[model samples]
Target chain A: MKAALGVMALAAALVLIGKAERPETGWSFRLPPGFPRPRVPADNPMSSAKVELGRRLFYDVRLSGNGTQSCASCHVQSRAFTDGLANAVGSTGEIHRRSSMSLTNIGYASHLTWANPLVDGLEAQALAPMFGDAPTELGLESAAQLEARLAGDKTLQGLAQEAFGAGGLTLDRVLKALAAFERTLISGRSPYDRYVGGEVSALSPEAQRGLELFFSERTECFHCHGGFNFTDAFGHEGAEPERKFHNNGLYDLGAGAYPKRDQGLIEHSGRPEDMGRFKAPTLRNIDVTAPYMHDGSLATLDAVIRHYEAGGRGGEANPRRDRFIRGFILTDEERSDLIAFLESLTDPEFLADPRFGAP
Target chain B: MRSLLLSLALTALPACRQDTSAASLSTHRLRFIATLDGAAANCKSLAAPPFRLRDARLFVSELRVIGPDGETPAAFVPDSRFQSVEVALLDFEDATEGCEGDSAEHTELVFEAPVSSVRAVTFTVGIPFALNHQNPALARAPLTAGAMHWGWRGGYKFVRIEAQRDGVEGRIHLGSTGCEGALHAITSCAHPNRGTVHLELDPATQQVALDLGAFFGSDKGGDKTDCMGEPADPSCHAGYRAIGAAGKEAARQSDSLAANTTNPAMGASAFTVIRRTP
Candidate 1:
């Protein structure tokens, strides 16, 4: 009897994922210097075991209803976790309205999605791509079908049992585990990150000058793209998540309006003032993530800089055009400097990390 | 050791809710039967454009049987996973005989309730703001069905109906909007975007007639068949009225979910309630 109890204890100590059991110190975070710890949900606490299991599920195509795509399908790590598509095409080849955003520093996003104000939890957000019907991503018709598919996979079934205790492969547990893995995606190893860490020699003099121009009143880029993660929409525990949405004069249909189908925040709020407003994504990997904006309308960083310089682009004087987006003039040298500064934010180690790669 | 692992599996799994409503005497069953034009409607008939409804699902909550003073109390199932104070999620798409992209069929939302102090019934047309943000996959009964989950930030579509008219596809997705806060909690919303439906019902009746004929009919003035939750949009007028909005312009608002206290002359629409019958 004593031997059986000892065996059970040993099994519990070394969870099925072959990782350390819940240690006395709990989940140890390896966040880079100067970054605060991210706040995780009470229900879905971060666990190394959960993260390990999630990595396997992330690469497995079987997670999709059609067994053709996974989370990694759209969020490729080499391109800073963005699929490098103008707009995301789903497992069934359905075209999504918006381009895939980088998941580099997703943990710090105060709000999830481009325009949605409601989806604040990563667990809840996972359901959209996995089950949403219209623009199908990882399409599963129903929960029962999902359960049956997971139950059939012997290896996954075993890992899920260890991660969620008795609740093997539930949609709740899957989402929680996926979120736990996503929270660990910290990227502060770029040259800019090193420069910010008291190593002024890390950035080229051109990049250093570009950094100055980025924050200068003339450029005014920092108004929306300020902070360690480089977006106004960032927060952690106790810090009230900065809720902001802006319409950078992206469009004007006759009377200060965006296209009817893709009206950004206005579609959710019904307030005309919110028309054409969208969430400002993290600039951590701006260089690699091409064809930018909520709809991927802007093709290059140079083009983006030019757009800001031109101001409204004669879009019928949109009523809700962001005050900060009012056009600024810049010389050719200044444009290159700004682009260099944005490029300095990339963390090469994060882009090529084998751990984030497929198992 | 093997037995211990099995026990863990049993505890974590959502316990199968066997109709076991037969276990007690005081408990009575509740069901939401759907019909259209006074008959079992055909959701698939791509005759023209808007006339063909490829699929449809509606989420109903906060069911209350009115009494002399206000809402009366009843013996709610304590073990039920989704049983809020006095709320339930009624699904109509579970009956997937003629639907597209769906396999599991739920004919009606059937549950157990203590049939006492019941008179008129009142419910909401969309998901309440408080319960709208939580992980729907973790919840039970209707929430577990999985078809209702829409976009993550968008949450569940309170009323989602899809159809193709003149080869032009139209869909209506209704739910709370302009809400803020984390997924676990929402601090506030500029527009909660939910409408309440009140019906003068008798206690003897067990089912409410859910007719969708008027909901599918074409509104000549409206631009599209869908009401995508925009305030003052031309599309929401017909839908806002059909679900119980009496006022033309003010009844169905895409911009504000706040009740119009200033305009007392305009009456609220009570469209979801077709009739109360046994």
Candidate 2:
């Protein structure tokens, strides 16, 4: 009996230690070094179940009213989550006012939508495409309709409950799950990242020279698009807040109009001074997400370079152009080098990675 | 066991002390009413009344409360600053128009009294300097979601008053002038063509009057014109030229209308004091 009691005591102690050693449950996020996590809403905490559910929802066409479009319709995973279209078309066949932005590393974005400054998080952004009256995408105006739709599918209902727990399948819960999934879609394993992480042979000679020019103060490309993400307006798991908008002299269409279709931040703020200001997109896969700017007017990378080289469109005569857009003269070889460097940002492995592909 | 209890007790002592200190901070109630003039008062009512306005919205921003005792220079806490305070000119049902037209409407703003030694209150007629300098995409609440945002013009309209006369609606849109796009590269654009109005608030009085006629010249004679849709109308620009030589005159008139007015104090009686109950 004495021996058995001693053994039981030892067993209990070992069990306690094992319990302590067990990793915490739910989702745990560890942002890459030098990367910061964007601010998450207090209501929605990140969880693995919710993220998995949101991933499925993001790819599911059933979220749309007519079951025709999903978040992936405008944001293809192959092209760094940005569709090749100049302007995205809604599920209802209405043309969007602005170009579709790449969702790569969008978890670190300070502002979510193109023009709306109020949409600071993914949860808020999901609402616009879901219920916004002006050019509606998913016509989820009634809660009953959403509930019935979710209840129609047994698998989706189970997934929603597991993801949202006692909160049930609500609009807010859907938004939270979608946001969680987006937060997990972190992409930082490019060759450039490897080069920055101390690998000497990661970059070609031309790419290295291009990187130098990019970082150089003379070119000043790094001023707005700097740091690990190549965009200064980055917020992540632990980064300090940064500005989300800049006037890159994309348009000076004269007489206080910013190219009728693409009003940029002006449409949202309605401030005259805010006219023509747009969020600077991340250059993670610039080679894939072509037709740059809020309007997607520039088709080729060379055209974008030339536009920056000559200040802006409508010539040096535009009175309303931003000060930073002073037309800089770039040599032909230098321009090509910059293009090569930009191409190096593409992660071929990321494109072919099956983990992110449609299941 | 005794030591564990002591440790818990000691850890909780600081929190109790902090709670007591936070409870001691004084809070005050603020109340005031804005009076309008000219078409402002008339616009509130569909039926024509003397000294009435056609559109009765009041654009107020940068609310600063002076202590109850006297005017004290206080630093507005960051993120606590307000941009534009809007009092709608008309009240309408979800889809249909209400019987009552635009009248002098009352607005309420409340904030924790920063300092105990309260005096009077003051506020600017336009957005605060800090928020005004920020990118419009980042501005939230009372700043971006207002009629004052004149999409891409680059500045907040300090005052936006609209009125209709002789089958033509007149508007007074005021903001920073001499704005030369974002690419000018200069730190300071030219000074606003117009000046700002400084409002001194007396909580006891609970009434403030703003004259509306000051925004325009005599509507009876000298070519009564409209500034509404002036961006597209060459004739409107021509009319402005006849009114004054440059846009500076219009801006100045807007400033005067925003600042000094005594005629249309219609909503002063309805002013409600915002006070925190003990």
Each model's lDDT: 0.66, 0.53
| TM per candidate | 0.78, 0.55
- Model 1's i-RMS, to one decimal, reads 2.6
Residue A346 displacement (Å), model 2:
1.5
Q: By DockQ, who's the top model here?
A: 1
Per-residue C-alpha lDDT of model 1 across residues A244-337, encoded as one tens digit per residue: 8988887877677788768888776667789889999989988998989888889999999998888865533757788887788889998898
The alpha-carbon lDDT assigned to residue A339 of candidate 2 equals: 87
Which 10 residues in a row give candidate 2 chain B its minimum summed lDDT? B87-96
Per TM-score, the best of the predicted structures is 1
Best by lDDT: 1
Task: Give the residue spans of candidate 1 off by over 4 A.
Answer: A1-27, A197-201, A237-239, A315-318, B1-39, B43-50, B61-98, B108-133, B150-155, B187-213, B220-223, B245-278
- The TM-score obtained for chain B by all candidates, in the order given, is 0.64, 0.51
Q: Write the per-residue lDDT of candidate 2 for residues A134-153, one digit (tens) a residue.
A: 34455443333455577666
Q: Could you give the CAPRI-style class of model 2? A: incorrect
